[model samples]
Target: MDNRKTPIASFYANLQVFKGYAEKEYLPYTTSAGDVAALDAALDNILEEGIETVFARHDRIASAVRGSAQAYGLELFLDSDRSNTVTAIRIPEEIGALRLQDHLSENYNLLVATSLAQYADVILRIGHMGENAFIDKLIYVLSIIDNGLRDLGFAGNGDLAQLFIDIYKENI
Candidate 1:
C-alpha cells in the first residue's frame, strides 16, 4: 500500500515529466490547446506593445499609486523599493481595512486587496498591472479610495486622484 504507487499520487506526479522537459528530451503529454492559444495571444499583445514599454507603464502606474497614497496621508507598508505591480498602504486604525474595502466595492464598484495573516485589516493593497496599469483606471480607483476613506471618517490630506494624475504625468 505504498502511497507513491497509488492512483491518486500518480495523478498528481510531475517530477518525471519535469525532469524530462528540463533535459530537453521529452514532453510527457500534450498541453491544453486553449491554454496555448491564450498564451500565444498574450505574447502577441506584449510583442505588439514592446516589453520595455510594458515595464515602463507598470513603473509609472505603481509610482503614481505610491505618491497618491502618500498625498492622502496614508503610510505605505514598505517605505522604499516597493513593487511595480502593487502598493500596500497601512489602513488607518480608526477607519479599518474592511470598512474601506467594502466602501469602495459597494459604493464605487471597485475591489481592493487586504493584507493576509497578521496584517489583515491593517493593510490594503492596490494592484496596478497589465490592463489595470493605466492612468485613467488608476485615477478612477484612487478617487474611489479617497472618497471611501473620507466616508469612513478618515480625513485625507489631499485628493488621491489628482495626486495620481500629477505623479503619472510627471513620470510620463
Candidate 2:
C-alpha cells in the first residue's frame, strides 16, 4: 500500500510441501477432499499473473495520475520520480482530506480516502490496483479532483479530460 501498488496482494512461492486453502478462508479452513488441488492451482495462477501483469498496470495508473496532477498544477506529496501504486496528495486546506473524500464519493460515486493514520486528515489517497486499473477509471479519478478543486474555488489549469487522452496516447 505504501508503494501504492494494488491493495490486491500478490505472492509467489515454490514450496515443497504445503496445506492448500484460500488465505481468506477462516481459521481451521476446511474444503472437500477433491477441492484442495484445484484451489492451490488457482491461487498459484493468481499470484503469478499478478506479478507479471499488475506491475505494468501499476506503472500505467501511477503515470496517468502523476501526469494528470502535473497538468492540473496539483502537488503530489510523494517522490515524483518513483512510481507507486497509490497516489497520495495533500488535500488543499480549503478542502479537507476526509471532506474531499466524502464529496468525491457522494457526488461522483468514486470511493477514495486516507488510509494512513498520519495522513488521516491531511493527505487523500487513491489506489489503482489489479484489473480495476483502467484508463477511463483514471480519468474519472482526475475529473473528480478537478471538479472538487473548482467547486472549492481553487483556480487550476483547465479541463483535464483531454490531458488524459494525450497521456493515453503516449502510454499506448
Candidate 3:
C-alpha cells in the first residue's frame, strides 16, 4: 500500500521466471561470425525502420497527450515535442497514483503506468508506442481519468475528457 515506490522491479519479479540462462534460441553475446552477421543484419534493418517508426509514434502520442491533459485537468510536466511515446504529466496529489491505477483497473479494466522513483505518485507516464498506440486508446484513458476525478470530487468540467483531437482557437 506504500505509494512512495516505483513498481518496475516488483512488476518483473511478480512474473517469477527462473533466471538460469537466456532463452534457448537466442545467440550468446560472445562473438561468432554467424552471430556477428546476424547482429549486423538486424542492426541494419532496425536502423532503417526504427528511427522512422519511433518518430511517428512519438509524434502521435505527444500530440494526443498535449490535447487531453488540459481536458483531464492534468498538469503538463514534460513537453510533447521533446518526449518519446512515454510522456509525463502530473495528476492531483490527492488522487495518488496507486489508488488511481487501482481504481482504473477495477472499474474500467485499465492500467495506469508511472515513471521513476521520487515522482512516482504525482507523475503518470502515458506510453503511446508499439502496437496499441491508437488515438482511441488515449481517449479512453482520458475518459477514465475524467470519471475517476469526478468520482473523487474534482471540480473540473468532465467534457474535456471526451475530446480526442488537439484543437485551438485564434483570437480575433
Candidate 4:
C-alpha cells in the first residue's frame, strides 16, 4: 500500500507546498486583496500597540466580563479552563438563550452567540477579543445584556455594566 497516495497524505503534501509558497511571498490561489489589506492594517496596529499590551488588554477585559457575570449571579460554563477571548455563561432556565440573544439584537443592535446542540437553550457566549476587547465597548455590551435580562424578568444581583467597569478599573 502506498500510504503517501492516501487523501490525508495528499492533503498534507498540498498544505506543505502552500506553506512554502507563503514563505516566499507567493500565493498559488486567488485571495481577496481587501482582506489581505485589512489583515495588514490589523497587524500594523498590533505592532504599534505592542503585542504584550494587546494581550494585557484582552486579559483585563476577560476578567471584567467574568466578574460582571459573577455579579449578575450567572454561572460560568467553564470555571477554570475558560478562554481569555470568549466567556460561556449558563443562562437561567427562565430566560431562554434565544430570547436573550434576540432581545439584545433587536433592542441594542448587538448579537450574542448561543451554544450548540443540547446546550443551545441554556448557554450564551460573549466574545471579548481583538477590537471588541476595549472597556467602552464592553461596557456598552454589558449594559445591553443587563437591560435585556431585566426586561425579560431575570433579576440580576448587581448592575452588570457598573460591575464590569469596577472590575476593569481594579485590574488596571
Candidate 5:
C-alpha cells in the first residue's frame, strides 16, 4: 500500500535470481568456449520454456481478475486484495543483444481488462533478459514495477495513468 516507497527489495530479489540464471546457464554458453553447440541447443530450450512461462503466468493472473470482477464488480478495480497482472511480449529470434538492450527503455503495459477477467484486482510480473548483458536484470525489475503499479492503478504520476491507458487503447 505504500506506493511512495518503490519496491526495491522485491526488484532486487527477482533480479538476483535472474542474474544467477544468466551467469550460470546463459552467459557461459554464449561467451565462453564451453560447448557452443550444446549451449546453443540449451539456449533454444530456454527460450521456448521462457516464453511459455511468461504467457502462463499472465493467463493465471487474468483468470483471477475475472473471478473477482464477477464477485466484486467494478469495485474490484480499486481493491487491494488482488495479485498483479503481467503480460510479456513475444520475443522474436531476430532480436539480437543490441535490440534487447534498447528494449530496456520501453515501458511494458497490460490492460485493465486482463485484471477484470479473473477478478484478480491486482497484477504483478517478472522480466528476464533477451540477449544482452544484464538485460534480463533490467527487465526483471521493470516488470515488477509495471505489473505492480498496474494492479494498484498507480502506473503513473498524476494524469500519466490516464495518458498511458489512452495510448494503450489506441494501439490495441
Candidate 6:
C-alpha cells in the first residue's frame, strides 16, 4: 500500500475471483450439488485464465490513469482535516481516491479491533492492546502525529515521521 502504485489491481483480481463463483453457483440462490460443482469449476477457471486477464487489464488501466495524472502534474493527497492547510495539488481524480483510502483505513481498523476484542484469551496474552497497536501501531501513531501536524496547518519536514523510530531505538 505504501507503494506509489496502489493495489487497485488487487481489488480487480479479487473481483474476478468472486465473479466466477457468483456466475456459477448463485444463479438464483437455490443450492444444488451440480451447481456447486459448476461453480467450483468456474472458480478454477477464474483462478487460471480469468485472473490473468483481469490482472493485465487492471494493470493497463492503472498505468493509464497514473500516467494521465502525472501528465498534468497532479497529485493525490489525503488532507489531515477538511479545513486548515490546503494539501491540494493538481490531481483531479485523487479526490475520490483519497476518500476511499481513508474510509478503507478506518474500516480496516474497526474490523481488527472488533475481531481482537472478541478473542479475550488472545487479548489477555498480549497486555499491550488498543486500536493503535492492534492495527499497525507504528503506522497508526506516525500517521496520527503526521496528520495532527498537518491538521494544525504545519507542513511536514519528514521529522515527525521518524519520532517513533527514535523513541524505539532509544529505549532499546
**C-alpha lDDT of candidate 3 relative to the true structure:** 0.64
In model 3, which residue pairs have backbone atoms overlapping below 3 Å? none
Q: What TM-score does candidate 5 reach?
A: 0.19
Q: What CA root-mean-square deviation does each model show from the true structure?
A: 5.9, 8.1, 10.4, 3.9, 18.7, 19.6
Q: What are the runs in model 1 whose C-alpha is more than 4 Å off?
A: 1-17, 21-37
Q: lDDT tens digits, residues 53-93, model 4? A: 99999999998899889988998888797789999898899
lDDT of each: 0.85, 0.69, 0.64, 0.88, 0.36, 0.37
Provide the lDDT at 136 for model 1.
86
Ranking by TM-score: 4, 1, 2, 3, 6, 5
TM-score on alpha carbons, each prediction: 0.80, 0.65, 0.60, 0.87, 0.19, 0.21
Pick by lDDT: 1 or 5, better one = 1
Q: lDDT score, residue 163, model 2?
A: 73
Q: Mind sharing the TM-score for model 1?
A: 0.80
Model 4: which residue pairs collide?
Answer: none
- Best lDDT goes to which candidate? 4
- Runs in model 3 lying further than 4 Å from the true structure: 1-26, 29-54, 79-81, 166-172
Poorly placed runs, candidate 4 (over 4 Å): 1-17, 23-25
Model 6, range 1-172, lDDT digits (tens) per residue?
2344544466444433454576576533355899789789768866776666644433433333223223333342322342111122221232332332344356443221111232321110111111222214444544553453344344544544354344334433
Best by TM-score: 4
Clashes of each: 0, 3, 0, 0, 22, 0
- In candidate 3, clashing pairs total 0
lDDT of 2: 0.69
C-alpha lDDT of residue 14 in model 4: 64
